[model samples]
Target: MFGLPRPVKRLIVGAPVRADGQELDLDVQLLLLMTRLENGDLAARTVERARRGLERGQIYLDRRPSRPVRTRDVDAGGVPARLYTPQGLPPGSPLLVYYHGGGWVVGGIDTHDTVCRYLAVHAEVRTLSVGYRLAPEHRYPAAADDALAAYEFAVTGAEKLGADPEAVAVGGDSAGGNLAAVVGALAARRPAFALLLYPATDMTVRRRSRELFADRFYLTDRAMTWYADHYCPDRARRAEPAASPLLADLREFPPTYLVTAGFDPLRDEGEAFAARLADAGVPVAARRQADLVHGFANMWPLGGRFVEALAEAAGALRTGLYAGPRGRGTTGGGR
Candidate 1:
């Protein structure tokens, strides 16, 4: 299926991660740890474990860099976020208000610093990677609120960051993708496109795919449940539009390009969200990534396809954002 060279194929599938709990691999161990955190009575326990995990730098997002990295911070309005600007500055280029993915719990700016630099260099754009406060510490609206706040800040302060406001967009993978989707919805009237990468569209956790693959998939049912629990502490938060963008009406979303990994547990929800968006007359382009598992975007060495993915994303941005002939806002004539 994936016509990669011999060694790369093995890398794609991973080293046969065993299902038996005793023979757990890194993800499985983390999965077990997260499960414990979710069910525990102590709130700080969960937050501390997540913080420790991030600090360890042993998670899926361990991509290394080969560029001159510049660090800075912007008020995610009130939410805190660190921004990474890559080497080889491209003046007045498009900006990506990126939200890092860790099911909204485990990831932050430092963990994702290399990946952001990769995107900025490969896509030739300025990416403001938002470190919106993690969940199980902050609830639903907090991260979503931070995503939007960062976006507005980018819009208001584009010149200072050396980005063009007219060419700005929003995007993320997993939880960040969900944030990007909701951010697009909330700022529909704003001049921006969306580059969603395997977004968690539905928070209800009722998709048949999840049920079927719960026990065995790359993204185990246990892991998904754990992620959701951490992202939404109380029952009420899970149902909110910020936490569950799929539950919200999609009529007002911006032009979007949603990417889904074929083997991911969230595949069905991403597909469903695309359907809903199209049904609501929103322009949407979804690419299904076959021959890959969940979290491939963050697995650079394993998949080695992040480079190609970055190129595709750049092309999508060109089509979605602009006043050019192929841009979304233009038609045969004006509306």
Candidate 2:
């Protein structure tokens, strides 16, 4: 405090001053401090420690097990995925293929296990949580490639999993949400709908929120830049639809359920993507958690509202995935 610069002082404080005058939820406020990511090098040890800190905080919330759902590990195309199915949903239920968010660098199946289980039981649909290849290792196109593969696996292996191929959707939070959007745009076989939770939709474009909520929020602009550096090191590739789906055409995007946290730096871009989808004549249902921060979906330590939010998202996924028809489709993975 005596010698630090203003920027360093702000990082130390880490309290968001919301433009809307809304206060952050108490649990979330505590979590922001407990899980505050380091601002230094994005080295393997640093990232690992950050991930462990997040998981440690998560243990308190994830301690309570999800409603008796059954989960099994399987290869979704070439990608590894954990499939969650409700206890008694019968065969041929809807399926939602999900990706976990970690800026395509950190996070995996275990980090999002509870979220997938909650969705499976609450939404009454099968949930396939994908473990896509991470970046600074696999880089751009790898995660996108896995997302498409996982969707294809869901479509083709539906009957085998006791799911209805036609009633399948693609969804995820943050970076994973970006993958879902890309799959929606480029997958050879279409999904029934999409659920994007505070997605990083446009890496190439910076929005006002990126600057406004940059530091205090869990997802900071500086951290985002670091993630982008790892995920899409090439400047030109950052503009590609695979990396920034917001730049892609959205005319044929399925009905979408988009959620954005008002305090999240990614807020504006996620909203802009929803607007674009709506303008393209795609059915859209968008919600903003006015007092929440980024990563709320997986941060169980934040308590009830976060749980309720997951339920709300699951409900939306159920509604969108099963809305139109009950007819079944042929099951065969597209190469």
All candidates' TM-scores? 0.78, 0.87
Candidate 2 per-residue C-alpha lDDT over 170-279 given as tens digits, one digit per residue, 9 for 90 to 100: 89999999999999988888788899999999988889999888786777787788788888899988889889998998888888999999888999999999999989
Clash count in backbone of candidate 2? 0
Top of the candidates by TM-score: 2
lDDT of 2 at 269: 96
lDDT of each: 0.69, 0.80
Name the weakest run of 10 consecutive residues (lDDT summed) in model 2: 326-335
lDDT of 1 by residue, 179-252 (tens): 99888877644546788888898887678667655654446667677877877768767777877888887787
- Which residue pairs come into collision in candidate 2? none
- Taking the candidates one at a time, how many backbone clashes does each contain? 0, 0
Which residue pairs come into collision in candidate 1? Answer: none
